[model samples]
Target: MAYGQGLADRVRTLAPDRVTTATDLFGTETAETALALGVPPERISTIAAGPNPPGGVRGTGGEQARPADLERITDAILAGEITVPIAATFPIEQIREAVTLQAGRHVHGKIVVTL
Candidate 1:
């Protein structure tokens, strides 16, 4: 299947009533959509840098990072922490369960289904 930006689009459509006042660490492109809907730059966190940090978030590194890592290790671009993107927390073979977790069906983290 061809890749598309539909996922972002879906996020845009979430709670249309809040379209004019949604706020979070949505990306620049997503933030642009918010601006189009009357949101502000300061209200958003634009992490165009792939290895950069997300808003309100501390690091983007995987499981290898820790608080001590930042205090003890080299200041060499401290690994950024990233919340697990949906399916990573689950097995793909069990897609239905994943969808259930995403459909607001369960108390879970913000999730996404990726290929």
Candidate 2:
């Protein structure tokens, strides 16, 4: 899921043959945009909070990550099969700055907030 229009637009531009799901967490506009982009109606989904949210689709409760999943991920990291890039890190005191950088959406990797 993308938090802003820029990322969503990037997804649209970079998408390959199949897009399994398009979820709009913020509102209905993303879904509408997907339709405008010729994505089949059934392939789009939206999730938001309000007195009455749009869209009728309901998610089948997704599975929580099991210990085995974490173990496998850890193994991958140890084997150098997975790499996590840190875009920026900030102490808890500079949380506002970190958040502002994150909100800018130009970061290439995870922004770490240290306690």
Q: For residues 14-111, what per-residue lDDT tens digits would candidate 2 score against the true structure?
A: 78564555555455666666665666666765555234433543322126557688789789888997777789999999999999999996776789
lDDT of 1: 0.46
Per-candidate clash tally: 6, 0
Q: What are the runs in model 1 whose C-alpha is more than 4 Å off?
A: 1-13, 20-27, 49-85, 90-115
Error of 2 at 97 (Å): 0.9
Q: What is the C-alpha lDDT of each candidate?
A: 0.46, 0.65
Predicted candidate 1 versus true structure: per-residue lDDT over 1-115, tens digit per residue: 1113563456556655555333334334454555555555455544342454333322223366687875653443345433233334555667787777666634434554446
Per-prediction TM-score to the true structure, in the order listed: 0.31, 0.44
Residue 33 in model 2: shift from native, Å?
A: 18
Which segments of candidate 2 are over 4 A away from where they belong?
Answer: 1-63
- The root-mean-square deviation over C-alpha atoms between each candidate and the true structure, in angstroms, is 11.7, 6.1
